[model samples]
Target: MARIGITGHSNLTAASAPLVREALVTQLSLHHDRLIGVTCLARGADQIFARAVLDVGGSFEVVLPAADYRDRKVKPDNAAAFDELIGKASQVRTMPFEESNRDAYMAASEHVLSSVDAMLAVWDGRPSGGRGGTGDVVQAARERGIPVTVVWPEGAERE
Candidate 1:
């Protein structure tokens, strides 16, 4: 079984979503029935990855950045998708923080990294805009000797 974690841009361009989703599906298919996706369930890339996992008949786990992540971090426009994915997760883990700050996000990413075999990053090779962004997660995974696959499709772009 392969337990793969995900980190990516949350503001992907409209056209990039399908491209990223296709790439995720292709990658996840390699593991087939044994795939287990781990994600923070953020909008854009995280949600796309979760859907791809399910489409590939793979189960997934979620790592919430904080207790209030759903209420505080998820925007109204994305709440439905966030809740749906949460309900479908095989397991859900929440960080110890009450607020969804940068520290909490980083801690949650670290938690995901600790349990996964590899990391799938949907980054465009740019440095992270914040402390717990895709780049940071990818770097952390590499530092821990976990293999990381960058999955920015040819036409993928950030908003």
Candidate 2:
């Protein structure tokens, strides 16, 4: 079994990745019994991936970047459901980084990557804001030799 991680745009107004993630969940289940761990950032791709992982029988893990979930602010109506999912995760890891530094991103990302066998990138096909862009993360996944599947919305550029 091989774990699969996901990367994509955060703070999005349009959503096509959710459907893609649900499909991936089905694909993963049909192909492998691998554990599914996702960063519970509650942004673009994180929420959908976590839900899909939960939908299947695969183990779910949340690699948070802090000791408290307070830093994770969620506006979803199913806030309770989100909390419930994280609580049910097989493992929960946090780095407890106060400053937004490169080391923090690397440590958190490394933790996420360590448990994964492949990556599913749901990008907008554009330059994401900040250093923690999904594109950069996908590149890192490639560097780590993980197979990647990039899913973009309709009309979004493809490579």
Output the number of the lDDT-best candidate.
Answer: 1
RMSD of 2: 3.6
Q: Compute the lDDT of residue 156 as modeled in candidate 1.
A: 90
lDDT by residue (1-159, candidate 1, tens digit) is 999999999999999999999999999988854899999999999999999999999999999999999998899999998999999999998989999999998999999999999889999999988899889999999999999999999989887
| Candidate 2 wrong stretches, greater than 4 Å | 14-18, 72-81, 99-103, 153-159
Per-residue lDDT tens digits of candidate 2, residues 33-79?
A: 55666674555577767777767767677776655443444555647
The deviation in Å at residue 98 for candidate 2 is 2.9
Highest TM-score scorer: 1
Model-by-model lDDT, in order?
A: 0.93, 0.66
Q: How far in Å is the alpha carbon of 143 misplaced in model 1? A: 0.7
